[model samples]
Target: MSYQVLARKWRPRKFAELVGQEHVVRALTNALDSGRMHHAYLFTGTRGVGKTTIARIFAKSLNCERGESADPCGECSVCTAVDAGRFVDLLEIDAASNTGVDDVREVIENAQYAPARGRFKVYLVDEVHMLSKPAFNALLKTLEEPPPHVKFLLATTDPQKLPVTVLSRCLRFNLKRLLPDQIAGQMRHILGAEHIEYEDAAIGELARAADGSLRDGLSLLDQAIAYGGGSLKADDVRAMLGSVERGQVFGVLDALAAGDGQALMAESTRIASFSPDFGSVLDDLAAALHRIQLIQLVPGYRPENHDGDDSALISLAERLAPEDVQLYYQIATTGRRDLSFAPDARTGFDMALLRMLAFRPSDGATPAASGGQRSAPSPQRSAPATPSAPAAAPVQQARPAPVPSHATPALATHAPAPAATPRVADAGGMPDWEALIQRADLRGPLGQLAQNSALRGREGNTLVLALQPTHMHLAVEPMVSQIADRLSEVMGEQIRLRFIGDSQGAAHTPAARAASARSAAQSAAEASIEGDPLVQALKREFGARVVPQSIKPFES
Candidate 1:
């Protein structure tokens, strides 16, 4: 005896045997039980999701000899013949092959006659959408007003192609694709009934490969059973499906968390040897990252349900910051779509990895300082040397402790600290207006303006700021309020800021250069602290680290 594949062997003999799609089943069962069947019924869904299969079952139920019911008795001659595809009253037509108007006209002519062997004459049209428009028009009248004994069951994967006129005459039921868990459960039942030995993971792999189609899943299972020679394993299924193992994904993620570029490259090389699809690898990476995000957000996520090595996955998830995991997921998802245009899969994969590394927080290196100079306070002065002639005359000095920036508000009206004193010009006047503006701290769009603008001294209630022709055109029109606020804060006055358009500029003086140098050093030191390797390692390993908002540096 030739063995039937599981798909055909376990095909739903009755509505009870159908795995998913309860809605369609219920509607048909009610129609059959109540004797309220429509003249024409349309079953629509993706291939292998049971559009055709349900049509057959519904046809059988309508003509079953034991009386119409949700659970038709298959032993009756009518049900048995329909199941065997030999019933005279139940005709199954392949609309794709016989779709001309003449074919449909022949069916219309036949519909006027009585049933040959059953209570109802059922015409099951598979892929009904393939019928020509003219064929549909020819069949419309018979479809709308068929004899009481005639039933039309139409099945199509693409119902949109069918004319709306034809659609209005039929009762439509949409069948949905099965979920993975549902498919897996059904496979377990079928395999157990067949006494075939199989691993759960292998079954899961088949379910995922099927992508929500039960028939496709069964077909894959049949192939897997043959490949395994009766017993199936997860590794065998992975190889058969050309799916990347979950462990490799974890390894890549672990390397990323550890910031080990060499380890990442080595893993890529190992994966390349298998000639695995890099696009699939990226997809798996995205899945793994998604799982990690769930773990981070859910508080107690477990990876035990996953079929591959999950220890590394859990470890990496625990180590990497949540934000980094989200970023990696984004990059990998984009890389998957861009893989086809790359020179090769490996190049695409490597470029994606580089992007991830580039955005990753620096381990210890400080980013380069940007923006302009800031004024620094002068050094404290010692009392003038005693005029006394005695050798080793004592020199008195006023040494002031460094005051924190936050402390300045408490003494806003007091004389400035000695170290906070602004630079004085020769012959005892404020520093040159142009030089003063050059020494002010500014950043972002404001910094660009300062580099090209001059200062026209303080007025009674306003500090007049001047810009070069190019700078004025660029900065004078907008951003006036922002410039005013920054200037007022720096000069410690209630002076309003106004920009004057001019082309002249001034170079930084010796004092301004010194101040700028000092400011750059301070910024570099702060950046170094923020990006320290030790701090980054702490963040990765424990999933927590000090951020600017969460912690402040201690004052010495």
Candidate 2:
């Protein structure tokens, strides 16, 4: 009458009941149904991913009282006994504990004999890789040719440790780690069946924390239920797991987006007060940033992370520059790795936040919070982007708007509505490159490519362009074709493009013009900040000196 934990109680008694291991289930089911069972079967995967569970279920399927079938009748004596761990034929071995030649010899000797109470003698060896080299050699021949009545079900989390000789003898089935959605679904089923009140978000937290193990997920769920005093709450689960809510991570990002140093620190303090794992908080931050980046770069991207508030995520995707998100993600992930070397978790976490703030993209386009204490320059004039950066994401600017880079073609053009867009030829005789790009309404990578290119006049029907050496990489066949098609559409003639490396025309490229504009804007912003009465007062009172490199001109 002792209370059984959820993991044990919910342990899959039949193949159909098992979750997130369909491939294994299908093969075993087919084998059982077709009577094509192998003598030695090895199930390998990470812990709690159903390696041992599937082995047991396969054993049950083989020895079921009704018949040898995939669907074991749970009410049958043989099946019930197997489920209860009382089946005489089912010899469960802990290879970790009994990892000697003597133990393996015992197993070998037992294999010669038939099942005591069932059709087949099933030896379920858990953590089979833990067996010593001598033990593996001792049972090697026996494993390859076990008696007709015997079956070997070897399970291991680390299959790599197993001897190739033993591995080759057996039909190896590598089980996969369960996905978050799969684990979450099972948790929901369990909670609903128990009639326990639980938030869906709480289940998600538990599932993610479970880290692709159903048993672990269930164990966490049990603990969460107990901690929440019966009903599972998102706050309680997050508190128990030493993890922050997605909203808290977003709060941190919001503060960064606003350029509010005080708000960022306060958010960090609030998170630390939870006594949460700083590494996990950084993981969450990186994960959010990843999803944000995907949203920014991937057209019509739908997040699969199952966050309830994707609208907010999309808003943030628009709010933060793509490059800023990428930078934050990089810092967060690398910071998480170096957490152990940090003096403490909080300090590491704080330093990571500071790094994000400090390294906030220098392009003058990222957003700064109004009336906020921010030292980082607004990304207005983009930093000199190396051609190596992602095509769509230009690094610089802290404005909430999509800050155009040196290569941002005010006129490159697109697949969007072409009817409303202006024609490039409207500039008359010789096509104005700037007017062509603007009128062509180029956007995305194509726009950037056009922005980085300057029209070196036309060669008959083809427009000759001078492409920056750094940006020549972006001039792929498909992009060229798209630009050609766009130009052909905008100008009432079939236009072809011939790109030449920048020799003299690089100075006249749209990107060059943008760079000049940016330089002037940057100087103006620096002068404005330096000449400000408040900044001058701070300089005199606190001996505060502005870091020149940190200054980026604010772009509207």
Candidate 3:
């Protein structure tokens, strides 16, 4: 006999055997026990998540010779036949293949007949969403009003595609995907029952790789067992799943935390030697960073049962700050998707590594002096002049005096300055418009409008605001009442807000300003390179032009 895979060998025999679907199982069991069975049942969930499995179990319970109960006796002829897929009464159809109107019509015609050999004729249609619109329409009436002894069990991954007409006719039970812990627990149980030797780390890896699908997890385990011959190890499962070792991920993260450039490059090269997936390695790094963040936020939440390989991760987590963990996680997460755009996997991995290093916070130390510092003038600074033109003089500004240590406590104690008073023409005089908006706690577009709009002189029971055309467009008409109410609060009386567009001002467009700043900086850098001492020294030493290109911020 051919060897049966773990998925099929350990398939759930009854509702009790199902995992991660207690809610659905309980509802169905109560319905069966109370004799409140619906003629048609819809089971919806992702693949390998027990949609069809539950349907089969429900069918067996409905037609079990022992009577309707949550636990059907497998010894009964009806249950035995159904479990073996040989029951004439249980018609299993794959709607993916048979989705035509004619195929649906055939099923509807078959529904008119009596049960072949069981108490009820059960039609189990898998992937029912694959059926065409007209096909769904053709079976709607029959599915809603099936014969007393007929039961229809429809299963689909994408239930949204099913028409409301068909959906309304059946009782829907949505099976949730199995959680990682739940999948890991089930795997342990299966491994113990199969007398297979396995490590908890190996089971956890398989569970994560399965991504919340029990059948997929079992299939992965079956493959791992065959690969390992008998005893499953973390390395075997990692290799089979093409996942990077947790140690390598921790090494890269450690290098990142220490800000060790040479070590980072060396570790990356070693990782590339194994032909490990660069994307998955980055993903593992992100996951490690997230775990570190969790551990930092909530002490004693560390995975005490972690395998030996996780020691480096815990140490790295302790060494790195919480903010740095969050930053690296973000960079690695974003860089993983951008990896495909690189020239090669190595280059992609290198770029991702560089990105992490680039954003990594410094430990109050200057970077190495070997690599020349790359600096760009401030955006507010004017562009540089040519040789013939007079060089622009650097502007000097007075620096604020440092706060005295004795005054620091007083400064901290003082509240922020109150907003300016509004020029009011009411009997009470001017009101504080800034205080009103602050009191209202305005946010988003409304807050932006209140921040930008200037309070003009007010008329009787009216507050006038000098708003730009753009601000007026955002705050006028739509949110006028909300702004008025806030103003009313500040004025200590009811006031109307009128938005008068400012014709004297030119609105600054953010995009145009950014483009102008970039252009000016590029021109200034080109001019500055000729005057740079390092560029002159390089020209004299190596006869090189010392062209400034690919200037990146140095990581300290």
Q: Provide the global lDDT of candidate 3 against the true structure.
A: 0.69
RMSD of 1: 17.2
Q: Estimate each model's TM-score.
A: 0.65, 0.66, 0.63
lDDT of candidate 3 over 243-353, digit per residue (tens): 866767776765665556676788898888777778888888887788877765664565545456444554554556565576678668767877889898779888778
Per-candidate Cα lDDT values, in order, are 0.68, 0.78, 0.69
Candidate number of the best lDDT = 2
The alpha-carbon root-mean-square deviation between model 3 and the true structure, to one decimal in Å, is: 20.1
The local lDDT score (0 to 100) that residue 98 gets in candidate 2 is 81
Give the runs in model 3 whose Cα sits over 4 Å from its true position: 298-300, 308-314, 360-556
Q: What is the lDDT of residue 556 in candidate 3?
A: 16
Ordered by TM-score, highest first, the candidates read 2, 1, 3
Comparing 1 and 3 on TM-score, the stronger one: 1
User: Over 4 Å off in model 2, which ranges?
Assistant: 304-307, 360-377, 380-556
How many residue pairs collide in each prediction? 1, 27, 1
Q: Rank the candidates by lDDT, best first.
A: 2, 3, 1
